[model samples]
Target: MNAPPATRGGSALVVIDMINTYDHPDADLLLPSVRAALPGMRRLIGRARDEEVDVIYVNDNFGRWRSHHDELLAGALRGPHADLVAPVRPDGDSLFVVKARHSIFYETPLEYLLAEYGIGHVVLCGQVTEQCVLYSALDAHIRHLRVTVPTDAVACIHPDLADAALRMMERNMAVRLADSGSTGLFG
Candidate 1:
């Protein structure tokens, strides 16, 4: 509810599933890749803030029925990669959207919120590039929102699958795989 609700006809950055505990089955393998993405993600976040672009963190609720955003954040801070969590943590002005599914727009108020904010374009940056990020991008595309995925800002569980997912998004969803600095949406 922060940041004036929406920026309609503007751009927003959705950080998906990054506030994770990394205690899942594939976590060990995914942690390193996710860490590698921190720099890019941080850079993008900084740019978004500087440009006054909406920074929306669409995180998983970790299946906790009553868990709130702050709780999820605190849990992640206590997780293995607290360093990763700290630098990209959402600020007071940032928007938070708690989701139970992969896609940010799935059964969530993301679509409605974006519409209210007048966000016609979205730049997605976060973990599990092949899963949540991919699904969210597709959902955005279908919703007719201009989608941009900063390649370096998204992490993956498997390199091969991640690459394939990027290609699929590019070809099918018309996603643009770019560097965080070149996203252009911020400027």
Candidate 2:
């Protein structure tokens, strides 16, 4: 296997689509997996912070055009599943990028931010393994950035699709698939 991102170049732990309200459709289907994955996500976040690795949260805007990071976070915290949101909440120093679509790079400043940070590799963790995570991996690959996805840190609405997506990422995009503990997120 290739060396983890931190050894290759600057790396950031990118948390995708996790700050959610759980008020949307399929949220019920998504919650169980989110709960299952929450501990791993927390561990990864803590590890990133301890290692002084940049931790960036890239989340959907929930169609609230004017909403920013704090606003979206506040809304989620007020929702029914605050327990789910609390453990993985972004710290004050965490970088936040608002995305309007599935791919984190689509119409978002993430690519530029990554460039500004000299980030050549990104370790992605969060929800919807088959959708946002999958697409973001592709976009990262196209940008010539190395990608790593921790199997335990990503939650999904559908297990079969998520498995297929993970396989596709590893096979097609050259993404490193690992458990959150072993991903060498900080290298």
Candidate 3:
């Protein structure tokens, strides 16, 4: 809500697409990968809140561009994964960004939000490591924001794809990859 300019690299924690649309098999295979990161994401959320760092839920609008972020969260919360998201939740202190496209940056206020806070670094923790997660990481790299994807905090449809995505991100972009246990020094 407060979009004031900042001098420091305001650290931000991004929780991406942990939705019911991904979890329920009838919806898609999105749950498997997302579920894998739940524990780590819960940890990150607490750490970020404790450190006074911004917590942003960068989720998909499921292509419904005009949808409200809260509505999507409501829908997800009402679904089968209600128990899963009960712990990792949003409050008045958090920011929620709903994207219609794969990348949070594609036709969204993400860039403005980052710039306003001078978030030169973003701790990426979310679902679908191969899709939205990958795209967001790429966008962060292009914007020169330092990016870190906690290995255990992100998940992919397959282990191989997840490994490949992390490896490629490390090689091609200026990204730092770490397991959840190792990233304790950050927040």
Candidate 4:
């Protein structure tokens, strides 16, 4: 097989499904770590924005006809879990790619968005590591994007699955799993 493609320049950031559904009874298991990781993610986002690199919100639509990027942001902002995801919604210039499934690239503009932005390196952050976040990292590998995921910056409903996701990414998929401090964290 040929090498997975490379997209992006400087560095780009992709914030995954940090929606309300994953913060409560639906998938509360991952909240604490994801919550703790928020500030770091926010800082990285801020840094990315300041550097003029692209910031894409690869959000999950949750299969809503009425649901869109803002809806997802609003739901997480207004819902009971608002405190967990609010910091993620940066003010402007951030792009969004609505995803219908786990991989952000699945039936979405994710690939085009990355290519358009010339994002050659990507940092994957957001919800349940065992699911969407994990799948997207694998997809990133297939896309040939150099991937870096912060260990403490991601979480999952089940601890094992979360840990396993990181393992699979590094061992099976060859992703770079770093600590939260590696990324450019800013004001």
Scored by TM-score, the top model is: 2
What lDDT tens digits, residue by residue, belong to model 4 across residues 105-158?
888877776676566678888777888888888887887777888776676778
Per-residue CA lDDT of model 2 for 133-182, tens digit only, reads: 99999999988899999999999999999999999999999999988888
lDDT per residue, candidate 3, 1-187, as tens digits?
A: 4333334366798888765434434234556666677898888888888888888887777766677867787887887778667778788989988777888788888888888777767889877788778889999888777788988888677678778888888999978888666644253
**Which pairs clash in the backbone of model 4?**
4-144, 7-119, 7-120, 8-118, 8-119, 8-120, 9-118, 9-120
Judged by lDDT, which candidate is best? 2
Q: Candidate 1 regions off by >4 Å? A: 1-8
Judging by lDDT, tell me the better candidate of 2 and 4: 2
Candidate models: Cα lDDT each = 0.88, 0.91, 0.77, 0.73
TM-score of decoy 4: 0.86
* Clash counts for the predictions, in order: 5, 0, 1, 8
Write down the TM-score of every candidate: 0.94, 0.94, 0.87, 0.86
Between prediction 1 and prediction 2, the one with superior TM-score is: 2
Q: TM-score of the candidate numbered 2?
A: 0.94
Give the candidate order by descending lDDT: 2, 1, 3, 4
lDDT of 2: 0.91
Error of 4 at 129 (Å): 0.9
Q: Candidate 3, TM-score vs. the true structure?
A: 0.87
